[model samples]
Target: MRVRLSPAALLTIFGNCVKIKSVNSIFDFFSWLAMAILLITAIPQIVLNYKRGSTEGASWLTFGMLFFGMTVLAIRSWFVTTDIIILLNYNLGAVIVLIANMQFVYYRIKK
Candidate 1:
């Protein structure tokens, strides 16, 4: 016996093989991993700032630029995915950079 398949039928078959939710979940997992890694990268700078009791040699301009960039990325991520990981990654990243900027100001004034 011979069988003929329509485009809709092929789509249905392929669709069953690959699910949108599963693909999104995979991306979400990676997003969470990336978020964790990126967040960790900021910690060393924060700790160094705290331990040293100042942010000398660190340019406030750098952190200021980072804050603005992160804030914009966070907003864009919210609109793009609204996924918790994406939201936290960008928003928390922005907050961290903002704190770094504050550290610069606080320490500069302290000196």
Candidate 2:
């Protein structure tokens, strides 16, 4: 006796073999790693400025570049995936960089 496979049955079998949630979880971890990196990258500058009572050593140029890159990441995120992982990752980083940028500008003008 020979068994015939229908398209739907084949698809069901293939889908069962491919765990989409696992793939998504991997991407989630990747996004979290990126968020952690973004979180730390500006902390040293923020702390140094706070300790020194000035933003003298920090560069607006660096923040500007970071802002530009994060902006692109945020925009690209709008059209991708479930619109949460990458969006949150990039937008939060953008906000952090924006705050750092404004602080730098304010201190630059103050000093």
Candidate 3:
């Protein structure tokens, strides 16, 4: 016996596929924009730390926690295919935290 698929069934499947793609596209765009914002916000702090050669009032505990947290977040994002935004933000944040922490530690030791 041969089986036939109805037009409504075919249309429903296609419609669902389009919806999923649309949602994914929207998520990707928003995630990309969020990552850009994170980068922009972090760059100034990173630059200031480099230029000043100090972490001054910034707490070591704070930066250390942030560095570790971001590192873990980045790794988690890597495991989830849909988390590119998180991956970018956390990885870049980790780098910035590491740089700042290093500067802080160096100045503290120097003094």
TM-score of each: 0.63, 0.65, 0.62
Worst 10 residues of 2 by lDDT: 78-87
Model 2, 1-111: lDDT tens per residue?
A: 999999999999889767787798897898788778878878777778878878876777888999898888777787775667567788888888887887887777888
Over the stretch 1-111, how does candidate 1's per-residue lDDT look in tens digits?
999999999999889768977897897788678667757866788889999999876777777887888889888987888568568778988888888888888888899
User: Candidate 1: which stretches are off by over 4 Å?
Assistant: 1-34
lDDT of each: 0.81, 0.81, 0.74
Q: Which has the higher lDDT value, candidate number 1 or candidate number 3?
A: 1
Per residue, candidate 3 scores C-alpha lDDT tens digits across 1-46 of 9988899999999999999999988976875685576567556766
Segments of candidate 3 deviating more than 4 angstroms: 1-3, 57-73, 82-111
What is the C-alpha RMSD, rounded to one decimal, of candidate 1?
5.4
Best by lDDT: 1
- Scored by lDDT, model 3 comes in at 0.74
